[model samples]
Target chain A: MMRGLAVASTLIVVLIALALFMRSKPILALKPLTTLLFSTAWHPSRGEFGFLAFIAGTLWVTLVASFIAIPVCILASIYLSEYADKRLREWIGPFIDILAGIPSVVYGMWGVLVIVPLVKNIIAPLFGGYSAGYSVLAGGLVLAVMISPVIIHISVEVLRTVPSDLKQASLALGATKWETIKFVVMKRAMPGMIAASVLGLSRAFGETIAVMMVVGNVARIPRTVFDPAYPLPALIANNYGEMLSIPLYDSGLLFAALLLLLVVIYFNVVSKMILSGSKWSLYYNG
Target chain B: MDKKNNIHVRRLEENIFKSLMVFSTGAIVLALALILWTVIRKGLPHLSLGMLTQAPKSGYYLGKDGGILNAILGSLYLTGGAALLAILVSLPVVLYLNVYLKKGSPLAYIARFSFDILWGIPSIVYGAFGFTIMLLFGVKSSLLGGMIAVTFLIFPIMSRSMDEVVRMVPGELMDASYALGATKLETAFKVVVRQALPGISTAVLISFGRGIGDAASLIFTAGFTDSLPTSLLAPAATLPLAIFFQFGTPMPEVQGRAYASALTLTLIILVISVAARLLTRKFTKHVV
Candidate 1:
C-alpha cells in the first residue's frame, strides 16, 4: 500500500508539471521562449507579452530580502546553537514558530498598514528624496521579516549538527568562542547555511500576497528602490481574476506561473544538493 | 603583555558580536508582538458574535449591514476537506519512504526531491494550476477547486514533516515487530502508525492551519460568494479573502472589519500551533 502511494506521489508532481506546460504551450509557439523571458511589456490588452519587468522585480525584492535575512539569520543561528543557554533557546523557539505560522495574508495586511507607511513617510523620503512607500523597498522589508524565521530555524538545526567535541577541543586549547565558531564550526556548516539561504530566497521569490500588496504592481523596470515594480507571482495574483477579459491574458499568466515554477525548482534543486553534499542528514534524513 | 592585550580585544569583539545576535533574536520576538498588537488593537473592538454567525447582507462592503459567517463557514469547509485529502495522500507516501524502501533508494529520493520543490512553489502558482485544472474540467471556482488547490499547497508540508517524525522512529523497533511474524503492512499500520500518532496529528493540524489561512491560492480557484456554500460545486468565501476584500474597500468601518477578520484568522493559527506543540510534548513521554 505504501509503495503504491509513493509512486502515486511522484505521478502527482509530474501531472502538475505536465498540466502547467500544456497550459503555457500556446504562448510558447507565438513567441520564442527567450523573448517571453526577456521582454517587460505585459500589456495583455494590447497583445504585448513580455515578462522581463516581473523577473527584474522578483530579483530585486528577493536580493534585498536576502541582504537583510542572511547575515542576521546566520548570526542568530550561531548564537542559538553555540552561545545561548537553554533558557534563551527555549524563549526563542516559540517566537520562531509563531513567526513562521503567521499567514502571508496577515503579513500583507501588516505591510499595507505599517511598512508601506513607514517607507512612504520616512525611508523613501529620507533616502530617495521622495515617498511613494509602495515600492520595492517596502516589499523587500516585509519579505525580509517573513523569510527570516525560516532561514533562522533551518540554519540553527544545521549548526547544531556540528559535533560538540570539536568546539570543546578548540575551547580547551584556549581559543575564544568566537574564534572556534569562526574557524571551525562555521566552516563545517557553510554548505548547510548556504542551503538555508537558498531556501529563503526561493520563498521570497514566490511570495505573492505580501509582495503584491506592497510592490505597487506597475509593469515597469524599477530604476530605484523607491520605484514600483511587478514581481511574477504578484502579476498572476492581481490579474488572474480578470485574465479571461483579454485575449491571451490567461495564457500569459499561465506562462508566468510556469516561469516561476522553473525558477523555484532550480533553487530547490540547488538547496537539496547542498544539503545532501554536506553529509549531515540530521534535518533532511526524512 | 601584548598577548594579554590581544585577548582583551578579541573578548571585546566577541561580546559585541554576541550582543548583536541577541538583538536580532529579540527583533524577531518584537516583530511578532508588534504584528499581534496592531491586529488586536485595530480588530478587537469590531469583533462581535454576529460576525461569526451571520452572513453579509447587501451593501456589506459599504459597512451597511452583515457579518462574515459565510466566509467563516466557507473557510472551515474548504480547510476541512483539504486537510482530509492531504492526510489520505500524505500518510501512505510518508510510510513508503520509511517502511517500504530502504534509505537512499532512487524512487524515495525522487519523491522527497519533488515534494521539496512543491513545498517551495508559492501558493499563487497553485492558484493558477488549479484554475487551469478547473478550466479543463469545466468547473467554476468553487469549494472543490479551492480544496484541490489547497491540498496541493499543504500536501508537501504534511508529508515531509511526517516523514521526519517517522524517520526518528527507532529501526530496531520495526525490526522487532517483523521478528514477531507481522507482515510488512501490518507492522507499518500497527506499530509505526501508533508510534508516530502524535507527530502525525501535529502535521495534520499544521496543514489545516496552512489551508485555512491561505488567500492567494484560493482567490481565483474558490472564487467568492456572499452566501454560504451549500454544495462543493458552489462558490465559497474564505476568511482571508474576506479580509482582502474588506481591506480593499474604502469605508473605514469595513476596513475595521477586515482587521477583525485578520485577528480571527491569527487566533485560529495560534491555537493550532499551541495545540501541536503541547501534543508533541505530551505524546513524547509515551513514544519509544
Candidate 2:
C-alpha cells in the first residue's frame, strides 16, 4: 500500500508540473504566442519575431523529409518482411538494427563536412543557386535516410505478424503467392502499417541536431528544397543555450515544446487505438 | 518431370528477386559502413588522450588540444546514474501497471497518454523543462539536473517496454499459477518475470543506449564542464555534447576528435542494440 502511494504521488508530481507550467494565463502572458510562432521575422537579437519564414521552412523540410522516407521505407519493409529468403532476412535484420543505432551526431558530421560542400559547389548551379550551401535539401535528405530504419522496423514487424493461416487459406483457395500476399497479408497488416507510418511521422516531426547543423538555420521559408530554414527543435538548440530572457526565454521555448508534446500525444493515442481496436477485427479478418 | 520443370522456373524467378533483395539490403549496410568510415577518417587520425583527459581543447593544428576527458567522465556519470535510478523506479510501476491497472481503465489510458506524450516531446523540450526546474531550484548545469532531464526522457521507454514484456507472458501461465495457489506477486516475480526476463533486459539495454547517445537534451540542462566529475552535483561533459560543441568550433583537431567521439558513441549504441535484439530473440522464441 505504501509502495502504491509512492508511485501515485510521483506520477502526480510530474503531471501536475506539466499542467502548471503550461497553464493558459501563464502562456498568454508570455508573448503574443501565435504571432511569435507565426511571424515572418525571427531576429530575436534585434527584437523581431518574424518566425513565419522559419515556420514555413521547417514544415516544408519535414514534409519533404517524410515524403522521401515513407515510400522507400515502406518498400524496403515489404521486401524484407515478405519477400526475402531466410538467409537474407537473417542478415538484413541485424544490418538495419545497427543502422538504427547510428547516432544523429555522426549523420550531422557527414552532412557538414561532405554533403554541404556538394550542395554548395556541385548541386547549387544545377538548381539555379537554390542548392546553395547547407540547404534544407541537405538536411531533409539526411533526415530521410536517418529515419528509414525506424519505418522499416515497425513496418516489418507488423508484416511478419500477419497470420500465416490467412496466407495458407488464400493459397488453398487457388490464389497465386503474390495474390495471397497482396490481398491477404497486405490487408491484414494495413492498420499496423498505419501505426508504423505514424510512428515514422513523429520521429520526423521533432528531429533536431542533424537538421540544425545542416539546415543553415536561416530564418526564411525556402523557395525550393535547396533553401535553408529553422525548425522548432533546431531553433531551441541553436539559440537556447545563449538565450537569457522573458520575451525570448524559457516560456517561448517551452511553448514550442508544448506544441510538439500535444501533437505527438495525439498521434500516439491514435496509433495505440488503431493497434488495439483493430487487432481483434484483424485477427478475425485474417 | 513436369513438376520439376515448374520448380526450375520458380527457382530462377526467386533467384533474380533474391539478388535484388540482397543488393537492396547491401545498400543499407553500405550506408552504415560509409558513415563509420567517414567518422574514422575525419576523427581517428587526430585522436589522443588529450581529447579525453582535458577541457574542451581547441586549435589542434596550432598544437592546442582541447581535451574532452571531463565531458567523457561527465557523460558516463550522468547517464549511468540516471539509468540505474530510472530502472529502479519504472520497473515496478510498469509491472504493477500491467498486473493490476486493468487495461482500458480511464486511469490506465491517461497513464498511457502521458507516456506516449513523453516520447513525442523532443529532447529539446526536455532540456527546456529541465532548465526551468533547475532555475526554479537554482541548480543549472549540475549533473543532477541532467539526470532529471534524462529520467523523463527514459521513463516512458522503460515503462512501455516493461508493459510489453509483462503483457506478453501468455495469460494461460498466469491462470495456471493461480490455479496452483500462487498469489499475484508470487506469480509475477517467479513465472511471468522469468519468462519475460529476456525481453525486459533488452528493453533496458535499448533505453540505456538511448540515454547515453542523447546530446541535445543534456546540453542545456547540464552545460559543459572542464574538470573531472568529482561529484554528481557538478556540470560535466558527455560524448554527444562534446561532438555538438566541437562541430561548431574552429579547431581541426577538435573537429576530428568530435568525429572519433561520435564514432565511439555510435559503436556503443550499436553493440547494445545488437545485444538487445539477440536477447529478445530468445524470449520471442519462447513466446512463440
Candidate 3:
C-alpha cells in the first residue's frame, strides 16, 4: 500500500505533463511547432498564435533579473555565512523568511507604487529617456528583489558547508581573509553557487503576477530594457479566461504553459545535477 | 618598501570587498523596509473596519464603498481546503519515502526529483492545467477548482518540507520501535509521526501561507466573484486577485483599496510566519 502511494505520487508529474500536452494538441495539429515558436504575430481573434515575442520577453526579464540578483545575492550570502556573527545571523534569518513569505501580489503592488515611479521619474529620466515605468526593466527590478531571498538562502546554505578547516588552513598559510574566501571557500562552493543561481533563474522564469503587473503586457519584442514586453506566463494569465471564445486560443495558452513547464523542469534538472555532483550534496542529502 | 606597499594594497582590496558585501546586504534589508513602509503608508488610511466587514458595494470598482470581506473569507476557504487536501496526499508520500523505502532507493530519488520539478513548475502552469481539468469535468471556475489547483501547487512544497523533517528522525528510534515488536506501520505512525509532528505542522502552515498568497494559479480556476461563495461550486474571491482587480481600475480610491488589500495579505503572511515559528518552538519540547 505504501509502495502504491509512492508510485502514484511520482506519476503526478507525468500526469500534468501529459494533460498539458493533450490540451495543447489542438494547436499543435493546427500549426507546426516551429511556426508557433518562431513567429511573432499573435492575433487570438483570427487564430494567429505566435509565441516568439513572449518567449523573448521571458528571457529578457529573467536575464536582467539574474544580472542584478546574482552578484548581490552572492555577496549577501557570503556575508551571512562567512562574516555574520551569531546574533546578526539569527536576526537576518527571520527577515529573509519574511521576504520570502511575502506574497507575489503584495510584491506587485509594491512594485506598482514604488519601482514604477522610481523608473518613470528618476531612473528613466537619468537615462535621457521617458517611460510609463511599466517596462522590462521595471519587471526585472521587481523580479530581482523577489528572487534574492531564494538565491541568498541557497547560496548561504552552500557556503556554510565549506568546512572551516579549509579556511583555517588558508589562514595558517598567511592568506588574508579575503584571499581565503575568494580562493578556498568560493572555489569549493562554485558548483553550488551555480545551482543556487539556476534555481533563482527558474523561479524568475515562472513568476507570473508580479512580473505581469509591471511588465506592460505588449505582445512585441522589446529592443531596450525601458521598452515594454509581454512574457509567456503573463500571456497565459491575462488571456486564458477570455480565450474560450476563440478557437485554438485555449490550446495556444496551454502550449505556453507547457513551454514554461518544460523550461522550468530543464533548469531544475540541470541544477539538481550540478548539486548532486558537488560536495554540497552531502550537506543537502544529509 | 615594495613588499610593504603590496601588503597595504591587498589589505585595501580586502576592506573594499568587505564593504561591498556589507553594502549589498544593507541594500536587501533596505528594500524590505521600503516595501513594508510603502504598503503600510499607502494602505493605512483606507484600511477601516468597514473594509473588513463589508463586501464591495455596487460600483465599488468605480471608487465606491466596499470591503474585501468576500475575498478574505474566500481566500480562507480556498487555502484551508487546499492545505487539507495536500496534507492528505503529502503525508502518505512523505511517510512512504522515509519509512517504507530504504535509504538511497531509486524510487525515493525518483519521487523527490519529480516533486522538485513540480515545485519548480510555475503556478501559472498549474492554473492552466487546473483549467484544463475543469473543462474536462464540465466544472466552472469555483472554490473547488481553486482548491484543486492550489493543492497541486503546494503539494510538492508540503511534501518536500515534511520529508526533510521526517528524514531527520533518528534511525535508532525506529530500530527501538521494531525491537519492541512493532510493525513497520506502527513504527512509522507512533514513532516517526510523533517525532515529526512539529515539522509537519510547520510544513502545512507554510504551504497554507503560500497557497493563500498565490494569485496566478487561481486566476483562471477560481473565477472572481464580488459576493462570498455559498458553495464549493460557486466562484470565489481571493485576496491577491482582489488586489489585482482593484489596482487595475482607473479610480484612485479603488486603487487605494488595492493597497489596503495588499496590506491585509501581507499581515496574514506575517502572522503565519510568526505562528509557524512559535508552534515549532512549542512542539519541539517532546522531540529528542
* Collision count for each candidate, in order: 0, 12, 0
- After superposing candidate 1, which stretches have Cα over 4 Å from the reference? A277-286, B1-5
TM-score of each: 0.96, 0.85, 0.97
Q: Which candidate order results from sorting by TM-score in descending order?
A: 3, 1, 2
Question: Tens digits of per-residue lDDT for model 1 on A1-286?
Answer: 6677788887766777788889888888788888888887677888889989989999999988899888988888888888889998987877776657888888989989999999899887677567588989889988988998888888988887899999999999998999899888999899999999999999999999889989899888988888888998988888876889987888888888888888888998898888985544322211
Pairs in clash, predicted candidate 1 = none
In candidate 2 chain A, where is summed lDDT lowest over 10 consecutive residues? Answer: A277-286
Best-performing candidate as measured by DockQ: 3
TM-score of chain A of each: 0.95, 0.84, 0.96
Candidate 2 CA-lDDT value:
0.71
Worst 10 residues of 3 chain B by lDDT: B1-10
Ranking by DockQ: 3, 1, 2
Best by lDDT: 3
Q: Comparing 1 and 3 by lDDT, which wins?
A: 3
Q: What shift in Å separates residue B204 of candidate 3 from its native position after superposition? A: 0.5
Q: What is the DockQ of candidate 1?
A: 0.60
Model 1 chain A: worst 10 consecutive residues (lDDT sum): A277-286
